[model samples]
Target: MTDSATSVFEADLPTLDYGLTDPPQQIYPQFRAAQQAAPVALGPIGPEILSYEMARTVLRDPRFVIPPGIHLSAHGITSGPLWDRVTRSILNMEGDEHRRLRGLVSRAFTPRATARMHDTIGTVINELIDDATARRSCEFVGDIARPYPIPIICALLGAPREEWQQFSRWAEDIFKIVSFDCDLAAEEPVVLAAWDEFDAYIDTMIAQRRRQLTDDLLSELIRIEDSGDRLNAAEVRMLAFSILLAGTDTTRSQLAASMQVLCEHPEQWALLRDQPELAMRAVEETMRHSPSMCSTVRSAGQDITLGELTFPAGTFIVVNTYAANRDATVYDDPERFDITRAAPPPILTFGGGVHYCLGANLARLELSEALKILAARVPDARCVGEVPWKPLLGLSGPVRLPMELCR
Candidate 1:
């Protein structure tokens, strides 16, 4: 695979987020318009990257797998801190290993399991609303969106709810790569320290789970028997790490974003308030319109044909989910935020195929609970100030979403 470089592509191309810059909505319209004009655009942001339909092509092509390339290694995306123990979970593994790990986690992330958590999730949502109401105004990202995902994840993993704060801190620090560069000279120590702390936490959990069995995902994974294929200690840690981080960060952002969108479109809020069944549709529509993720990177495994272009093996392809969801061809009046639209299935927010998000069910549950609580309790909640957003291009989320509580 081609290593990320400083100079390889044309300079005329508009440079996108390089771990900096904000206003992705504006950036996206310009980029999508360009891609629609020419599907295969050379990298302007970093190295010789292929964006647009080339992204869809790579995503659809079976030969262009996600692992074993510059995308995975250069990015330092091991399952968890214990790199050796769990080398082949779904997110990082290729071939048989990938399928095997995915199958195990898939069971825990089933529709039934996610559905069952809603009662507890609703309780959490209510508690958050109660807390917000006491304050009259609060930072939704820190107060609500931040805490909502952890307890559900803790419940699923069978971890202690008391330890949720520690997990939250580690997860936040670890994912700050979105805000700060991992490759920076001064960042090495901080990243390494965070990795070490989380790795220790997972190691301790795995060791504890081994001794005392329970119904949590870690214990369930420990009990799994594939005869010839079983998860080792390191693999278990990474799997847990991946699920916790991915599950928490992405959902939290979207949970907060859902509130932002609702606040922006008070009319949509009124419709959902009047008919709560529309909550799910609004969640789906909101995700499609303004997803939490900016883009996902995949390395071209074999020489692949994506539409009109031919990508060589090892090409680092940036799948701009934001662009794909807003494609005028796929979405009618794509720019307009209309939850009432009769949209088709398979929204791109959780992604698609084998790589689809494992916690998508829980995410939906969280959003549903939040909206239900907001509609019932904080119907008059509105943005108190301009939403403070991180400028990182790869992942765009509100750093602080302050909202006023109205009776």
Candidate 2:
């Protein structure tokens, strides 16, 4: 790891306090200021890498590796039994271990498999919309966004249908550890308890799968083999933990944020309603405009020089993807939310290189299908009340998006 003291760009940059409930729009100015100042500068938490090119380079660069478990513990977050397994899972892994795990999981989580979920995803969207429409005015997050991804992920994992809500709560609790803006010491106890319960749930599910094999992602993962090597029970449990944690609230946040964007910009909504072909493009635009996960943490594994900045191993770096995606140098009128925006460079919302999100394909499919369904069914829908923002720095989206549907 790069030592922070030796980094060339170690000058103190302006600090911005990110409240868990602060809206993304409120936080953009600070990122823009940092981007204009330097490619890499000190953030309130640590060093920040700002700018699309620099962030992309760092993500793809082998020198910038995922921070180890000790780094997280230093932030006042101690791990539980399940939390320990997940931190050592593929998400935090590096080099050969990451490659092997990624390969094994890819067999079960393929693009083709994601494509097959399109019909099911569409069905879920319509059902949620139907329920919202019947109410005329409903809290969009609770009614649609929150419930939408739960069953889909549960079915994919082969977990019991009744347990989706339980998984959702656990996933939500676990995500608190990732929020740089939150009170980690205060939230630690709840997070630990949630992990214990989640671990027990996953253990029981794994034992059941062992007894009677089912046809789901979990079963496939358990049976998946790479060069005659199979995942152990602990690895399988962690993978399930990863999928549930990565797939649920993150997808829900993205969906809610995209919906909020469309509601705010009715003109864009009208364009999508008229030309449904723009659904996928709109999803891309929303991701670029308001990414669910704004930033990621990395540490320099060895001495490295990026741009004018040089750092020794052990330096902490924050890749500000939110700022990067909206870089003026990369996009014209970078702040505008235009669905018809022409083919631009790929956004860093899903990240880049080896550590890129494994569920990117599935996420894109869900967002595209979600927008298409919304355009077709609720063209006149509009936000009706104060949309509450979740108080988390790592990911930002509305907690309750109240909306009045077309009667």
Which candidate number maximizes TM-score?
2
Candidate 1 stretches with Cα past 4 Å from truth are 1-20, 46-56, 67-90, 176-213, 226-229
**TM match of model 1 to true structure:** 0.83
Q: With candidate 1 superimposed using the best TM-score fit, by how many Å does residue 367's alpha carbon deviate from the native? A: 2.1
lDDT of 1 at 170: 76
Question: Which residues of candidate 2, in runs, are more than 4 Å off?
Answer: 1-6, 10-22, 69-75, 78-83, 172-176, 179-214
Candidate 2's displacement at residue 359, Å, is 0.7
Best model per lDDT = 2
Q: Where is the poorest 10-residue window by lDDT in model 2?
A: 1-10
What is the TM-score (0 to 1) of candidate 2? 0.87
